[model samples]
Target: MGLAERRKVMGYSQERFAAVVGVDRTTVGRWDRGETTPEAIHRPKMAEALQLGLAELDALLTPPPADFPECTASPPCDRHGSEGIDDMIRREFLRIMVVAGSLTTLAPDDADAIAEAVDRGSAEDFRLMNGHLWQVYQLARSKSSVNTVVKDQLGALNEALKESSRAGGLYEVAGDLFQLSGELSFDGNRYTDAAASYALAAEASSHARAYDLWACALVRHAYVDVYERRYTEAAETLDVARRVAKRGNSALSTRYWVASVQAEVYAGLQDLGACEKALGEAQRVADLATPVHPGGWLRFDGSRLAEERGARYVQLGRLDLAEETLRRALETKTLSRGQSFRRRGAVLVDLAAVGAKRHDAEQVVTYGGEALRLAKKTGSGYIARRLQALQGDLRTCRRNRRVVELNAEINAL
Candidate 1:
């Protein structure tokens, strides 16, 4: 049965179903008409609203022709294997929307519609949309689909930006969107794009006077400069970010977080004393207890000190120190969660990079393999870049089939 039929069977009017699903009535109409499908992620909630078991609801929702990839291809199983296929297809479909908008310029009306959708969208919507875009961005880079994918989303992104500015004003929303945009650009290796996005993010945060958000953007922007080997520019950017952070919020730990990042910028500039001093300052700020983090994404509650220290040592080519600090950091796994997979994986990649510099292929393979796994799981560009930098070391291990696989994976990423 179609959605409308199923809802009627459950004694739910279209209006009731729409209300239960937290969507508009028109959205329900679209679902009933099969013009659009409910997101897989929302299936469980939909099932609950229909008073059906999650599995049973899914079975009922499944289109006869769709069959879901696994049910048709795989051997029958006790559980519904179609769920996995459904998720994969859903993920790819969302990714395609972002890519299509980015590669082929969206129609003016379509662009406007996307803008409206974003402006009125919840954080959950942004997460679902951007998460898929990020995955595609990862695959596109590895598969050399860069031109087609990255270019296609630009028009929609521009439209989204205009809408974000109009709707977000000078507050958290604006800062959040700016940071997301900056990170996306940075992931694509478009440093200039990253810098521009970060600049606007910082400005918006400043208008809201949110110290942490502003400082985080500055730090993100500094990363681009660091990547370009422009140490002076990176240091200057961090310095400015630091000053703003210090003045804006004494209650906030953003200054300290920026201080930690700045330490690396100092290391990049070969300023050992300044780097150490900044580290000390970061520790001092981190010592304070806070009930809540100001910004969800910008939370630098000072818990990542070990990783920060390891990163600094890595920058200085002090492999021994880097390994020790990174190992210690890994020991404190409490700070590392699913969301922090990308950050922890980055540290692992750096450690592997250090092992590579020392011609320790065993160490490289051990750490690099794990890091590569994490990179694939998280789609982290930072980790991928670090692995890329270890190419020279991989060459030294040409005879090892494991290293061959590692190189292929890193190259693919």
Candidate 2:
């Protein structure tokens, strides 16, 4: 059965389910009528609220004409797994050194060390190291771990990109590196850096003729602009990404991911109509059930519906809805083990944000503290900025000493 049917079967009334899921009853109704669909991040929550397993929920969410050319054959996994362990480890160490330097305002030599490490690492190793660095950058920025280190990592990423010209055998590897670079910059609240990396990734994707990668890269780049309140720029980026995704097999998971992100951008702009349009498009692209596509890294099917949808609502100032949707999203299986800590921290921040909006100081203090604790574990700029934003919300709790302390702690970060 479809989402609405599933909810109904679970004995959830439209209003009740909307409350439980943190969305308007109308939005819930839209899902039932097939007029709208949840974003990928929200799928886990929807599955939980409806009491379905991931596999079954995914099947229900799949769009029709359920086959695509890409699904006709499996993409080869020819890239060697751990083909460059030594390089990866060395580069990782250097990246750590660079981040340490950046935070402590240490001498430029440490930053240089990170660059040298990247220069020596293999493409796969660099990519792997880049992933870890991205997380480190986020955590460090949130906790003010070390500016020098963060800068050093950024420098290392840049050096790696420069060394690896966007070409054959190295193009995908380089693209992955560039994407991670953008993610790091974005998480670090360095919008300009994020934009530059994403642009480079898009170029590499074009060279490799990988539409999904190109689209996802650009979409992420747009996210920084969206956060900066540059809605026009964000929308423009997504417009290009959407077109690029269409050029490939839209049924591919990345295409839907693009749609989901675009939906959030639309919501951020307060363009509810456009938001729904993108959401519908995402749902349509996600209809395919074929599992023949490649499935490591960058494999985002419409699997986290509640989180994505709820996040958009949160952006739209629909706090009541945001709470329900975000809470429901929390029910989804935690994101990948390595990544769950950061993602869950973000959701907690969102949940705390809703509480802050409601002037619920106790809830804010409770959730915000947990979020801060979790944020300390990762080096994500996104989480840092989120905590930063909530500082203003805590002003209402001036009378609440604990709330005042929480705000101070977050500010300290």
Candidate 3:
């Protein structure tokens, strides 16, 4: 058992544990995520709370070897037993092999070495690489640049699906891969392809009995409708997502992320009360004691809640709320490393839109110019798309020379 498991054994919520250790709640989250270590002074208190001696606490803190999946560092252990672990490794290894290309093509000795390593639990190799690819996708300047890797992963997953049984854990991996593929399609503005990918993801997640993954896929599918301006259809789809998420593991922020997107759908439908309620549900993610997301599939964590809420406010034509909330989101971005180019870019565009709607050319040029630079720098079609959508609002400030110039630059993009 690790610190998270031990803390639960000791009946300490993450908040209580952090308070006992004299640290912020998020600091505890970082520790649970293995992103940071406790200071020496904090270790003793941590050990005491976890009911472990200092040396034993150190052992718990030490990561499992890169080869083994002793346990994932976050979300705690939901599956138990050696049989479950073995089945998971067996199928996951199939995926790993496919990612490495044809196994038979490998030198005989190299192939033999991999077979031996699998017995010693080398599935972590594939697991970590999958997680790394997600980080790469999130941080890459050009979102579409991750397509080749995603396509390869999809090929592997489809192959695995051919022989794998339901509930064998490969389905969960399939769910993850399908979501990544959908994201790539969405970034390329292929809404139909994205929707199809999400549907497959949902099907895989359902077969796996992974409620969180299943719910998130539905949310993404609904977003395709939202993007096409089908607010009624999107709202209907998101309502189903919310129900599925209620069946999800509450430890993860799956429901909250669904609620977050639902807020956007409601905003599009011009239901201010429903939008506010959904945002409130999303905010409840912060009240959870453990890390909100696994950083792999469900990355809600409430880190971008401010920005999303602000954006929804913009959609609802509440300029004052949008401006104040988005400004707070900007300030909040500095505190968390989880902020991405897409996230911040979306926020800047909303702020710029707020300015346009209010007929404030200074706000328009100031925020819009910065957003334009991000669009160019990251080559993010999402940012450029947001900018394109703001053109009609820009007419309100057409008299401003800087606005005219910025419009020209955006047009070029």
Candidate 4:
């Protein structure tokens, strides 16, 4: 049996098996595909996990001979001298999306990549994979869980950047990848790391002249400031993002997403009129026609705007409005559930905050308890952070047993 088949027989899924070896699951995938080998450190554990002797494991790692090369020659060509990526390149790039991270080290391939231009086809390959990684990142419970694979993919793209004869497409890929790195950092509350990654993403997208991507990167950078309660600083950043998005595709929701975030910062600064005005601009997204928001890199389809609006109201101390709006948002089917629980959990936390404002112990326990469960279920640091912020509010009802238990749980996270 081959390595993949042997792994299945041992009842270890790729994720489980990778965890055993202390590596990203994609590394196990590359090993199964014969595109790479297990490092010395991983082999012994691989053998043990796969129920193989060291000798047998070594044999298993040698994949059966194939009719084609494991990886294609770069600056690709067919026998007829037609230029483009082959089926192998397409497949390889699918796996490559999760492989990259920060562009800290220059790979050895830089010299070779700079020798010939990477075509639009190759750039598209990276784009497709980059989009997939965003989907994976959104669905992942612990956002940090994606950190390793993203770093590895960035390394791969670092070489791709060198190989590019046409720089535009590759630069866009760089923007996309760096934003993902920023997202992982942001999700983990590593604001310093997030700032650095977002700055790189902004630079790359600006180089590609991709207004939406560039604007989004700036918006994300501003979020770090918002989290730190540096409302004025965040507003300055958003002002720039707003102008950039104006130059973006009119068909996109980029401007509206920027407006949505701007509303948050305005609420933070206690500027009710400005906050409401920004929110009205955000509401305009529901009117756009055709060329819908791309689910991967730009998922702001206005689906979560209601929840966002409600949360902003909470920030503005509009308790009555916040409670009503948040409850309505929860009733709607738009809030993602199942493994997609981040937004929903935030809504619950908001409702709990409203209850805490009223010193309503039952309401606090009801909403806070559900939010806590979602945080634990998803291993989501974002939800945990929101719940942590609510800890002070929960103290008003501390005499209640459920509130006390909830406080302890949030503290544990």
Q: Which candidate ranks first by lDDT, i.e. highest? A: 4
Off by over 4 Å in 3: 1-126, 163-167, 333-339
Model 4: per-residue Cα lDDT over 1-413, one tens digit each: 88889999989999999899886686688777765666555789888887779999988877665464444777553542342222232233333332322222333444223323335666776687787788779877777666555655665575565444435467778888878887776777678867877887787777667899999999999989988889999999999999999999889999999999999999998999999999999989999985558766677878788889899999988999999999999988657445358888999999999999889989998999999999888888789889998998887888888889889989899
Candidate 1, position 251, lDDT: 72
lDDT of 2 by residue, 1-413 (tens): 67777787899999998887665576577667764455444567777888889788878866565342333435533232433322332344345324332433433334323223333454555456555654554444343343333343344444444443222333454555567655655655667766776776776666556777777778888878877778888888888987887887645777777778888888978998888777887776456776614443365666666677777777788888889988887767665344466667778888887887788888898889988876666655566788887777777777889988887878777
Tens-place lDDT per residue, model 1, 162-186, is 3343333213444555566566657
Q: Determine which window of 10 residues in candidate 1 has minimal summed lDDT.
A: 147-156
- lDDT string for model 3 (1-413, tens) is 76677788889889988899876686687677775556455788888777779999889888886554567657555454433432342344335434333422432543323233332232343355568778889878888777645544444444443432221455566677768777877877768767877887787677557889999999999989987779999989888888998998888899988889988999998999999898899999999977778886688888778888889989999999899999888777452343577777788888999999999999998888888998898888888888888887999999889999999998998
Off by over 4 Å in 1: 1-171, 181-200, 335-340, 376-379, 392-409
Instruction: Give TM per candidate.
Output: 0.61, 0.59, 0.68, 0.73
For model 1, what is the C-alpha lDDT against the true structure? 0.66
Q: Which 10 successive residues of model 4 have the least lDDT summed?
A: 98-107
Report how far residue 309 has shifted in candidate 4, in Å.
Answer: 1.5
lDDT for model 3, please: 0.75
lDDT of 1 at 372: 88
Top TM-score model: 4
